[model samples]
Target: MNFNIEPISTQIEEALQQKIDTKTKPLGSLGKLETIALKIGKIQDTLSPALNKPAILVCAADHGITQEGISPFPQEVTFQMVMNFLGGGAAINVFTQQNNIELVLADTGVNFDFEKHPSLLDYKIAKGTKNFASEAAMTIAQCEQAMQNGAAITEKLHANGTNIIGFGEMGIGNTTAAAALLTAYTNIDAKDAAGAGTGLDEKGIAHKAEVIAKAIAKQGIPNSPLEILATYGGFEIATICGAMLKAAELKMIVMVDGFIVTAAFLAASKINVTIADYALFCHKSNEKGHALMLDHLNAEPILDLGMRLGEGTGNAVAYPVIKSAVQFLNNMSSFADAGVATEK
Candidate 1:
C-alpha cells in the first residue's frame, strides 16, 4: 500500500516558537519539553495543539528464527505474553492503565491458535513467519497483507478520534530479526547490530551476532526496503511499520517505542522519509542496536531508564511526559497573563 506522508509543514514554526517563548519561563527552561511543544505545535499546525484519545498498538507474533536459539526465551513465551496482555497482567497493561492510555493488541502471527478474545484484533497472517536463516521470513504477498492489516487498524483508530498512537511488539527472536534489518538498512556490521534479547549472557550474545552474520550472508542484500522487511522482518514489525506510515499519512503523532518498534519505524522512514517528521522516539532501549538506530535516525528519545521490554512499555511510561508537553503548551501562563516579570 502507498502512503502519502508529507513532511510536516514549517509554516507555523515561527508562530509556535513565539508562543513557546512567550510562556512564563526562561527562554528555554523547559528543555526537551520545549522542543516537544514546538514539534507538536507544528504537527498540528496550531499553537494550541492537543493530543486526544491516545492509544498504543501492541502487536504480538512469533519468529521462526527461535530455532537458532538466538533468544534465551522459548517461542512459546510470545503466545504466553499475548495471553498475559489479554488478562491485563503485563507491564504494558499496567502502565497504560496508570497513564489512562488505551492499549490495543493484535495477533499478527503468533504460532498458537487463540480462542476468540474480544479485545484482541485477529489480524493473523499465518501461524508465524518462516525462519530467515534458511529462507525468506515471508512471501511478498504475506508481508504486504500484514502491512495492509496494520494500516487498516491505524485508520480505524484515526476514525475513532484517536490522533496519537504508539507502536509496540511481542515476538520471540524479534531482536534478531530487528538486528538483521538494521545491518541491511544501515549497512552496519552484524556484531554491532546484535544484542542480548530476553537476558542472554555474553556468550549467547556472541552466538546471536554470528547468526545475524550468517543470515545476512545467506540473504545477500535487500534490493528495497520492503525486501529487507520481507527478508528478515517479523509480522509484528511489518504490521507496525504499516501502522506508523499510515499514522504519518493521517498527520497523527507517532510514538515509537524501543529497538523493535524503532526498527519498524526505520523501515517505514526508509519507505517515506517524512514519517520521521511525525514521530517521537519514546525511549532509548538498552539494546546496542537501538542506540545505533537512534543515531542513524538522528532521533532523541524521551526517556532512557535502561528499558528493554518490547511490549510498548516504553511508550506507556514516557506518555505522561508527552501529555505534559501538550498540557503546558495549552494551559501554561504567559508572563503577561500571570502578571509576572520577564526574565531580565
Candidate 2:
C-alpha cells in the first residue's frame, strides 16, 4: 500500500524548544514531557497543539498457528475477548473508558462470526489467516485488502475529528507471528524474538521459538515488507500497520502499544521510515524480545509498568502523561510571564 507520509518539518524545532526552555520550571525539568511537547509542536507544526478526539483502534483476529498448540489460551479466546471489548468488560475497555479515549473495535479476521455491534468495524479478511508455521499466513491479496481496510478506517476516524490514534490487538498465536515479522524486519534470531506469550512456560517458549524458526525456513521471507507481512503477519497486525501509516500521513500523534503493536510499527516504518516522526513509543512491554526490539529503534518508552496485556492498555494508561505533556506546554507560564527572574 502506498502512503504519502512526510517527515515532520523541523524548521520550528528551535522555536519550540525555546518556548519549552522558557517555562517557569527549571530548563529540562519536565524531562521527557518537554520532549513530548516539542514533538507535538513539530508534528502539528504549531506552538499551540491540542489533542482532539483521542482514540484507540483495537483489531481482533485469530491465528491458525494455534493448531501447533503455541498459546495456552484457546483460539476461541480471540472471539471471546472481542466480545468482552464490545460488552465493555475487557481491560482495554476499562482503561479507555477511564481515560475518556474512544475505543474502536474492528473484527479484522476473527474465526467466528460476530453479531453486529454498533462499535465493531466489519473488515474481516477471510475467516482468519492460514497457518504460517505450515503455510503462508495470508495471500498477498488478503494482506493488501487488510491494509486497505485499516487505512480506510483510520481515514474515517480522522474525518471524524480524531487526531490522536493508538493501535491495539487481540489474537491468539499472534506473538509468534510478531516474532517472525521482527526477525524479517531486523534479522533478530527467532530464539531471541520468541517470548512466553499467553503465559507460555520455559519449555513452551523454546517450542514457540522452534515453530518460528520452522516457519521462516519453510516460507522464506520475501524482499518487500508487504510480502514479509503477508507471509507472517496476522490480519490485526497488518491492519494496525496500515492504520499507523495513515495516521502518520494525517499528522496524528500515534501511540504504539505493546510488543505486537510495535511489530506492526516496524512494518509501517519499513514502508515509510518517516512515520516514526509522529509516533510516541507508549510503553516497554515486559514480554520477551520487546525490550530488544525497542532498543533496535532507540525508543524510550513513556512508561514501563511491567505490562504485557497487549490490548492497547499501555496507550490508555499512559495517555494522561501525554496530556500532561501538552498541558504543561500550554498552561505553564514562562519565566518572563510569571515575573520570575533567573540567575545569570
Instruction: State candidate 1's TM-score.
Output: 0.99
Q: Where does the lowest 10-residue lDDT sum fall in candidate 2?
A: 113-122
**TM-scores for the candidates:** 0.99, 0.99
Q: Write the per-residue lDDT of candidate 1 for residues 1-344, one digit (tens) a residue.
A: 68998889799999889888999988999999999989998888998998889999999999989999998788899999999999999999999999999999999999999999899999999888999999999998999999999999999999999999998899999999999999999999999999988889999999999988998898888788998899999999999999999999999999999999999999998888999999999999999899999999999999999999889999999989999999998999998999998755
Q: Write the per-residue lDDT of candidate 2 for residues 1-344, one digit (tens) a residue.
A: 79998889899999999999999988899999999999999999999999999999999999888898889998899998898888899999899989999999999999998878798889999888899988999999999899999999999999999999999999999998898899888989999999998999999999999999888989987999999999999999999999999999999999999999999998888888999999999999998989988988778999999999999999999999999999998999999999999787
Q: Report the poorest 10 consecutive residues by lDDT, candidate 1.
A: 335-344
Off by over 4 Å in 1: none
Q: Model 1, 77: alpha-carbon shift in Å?
A: 0.8
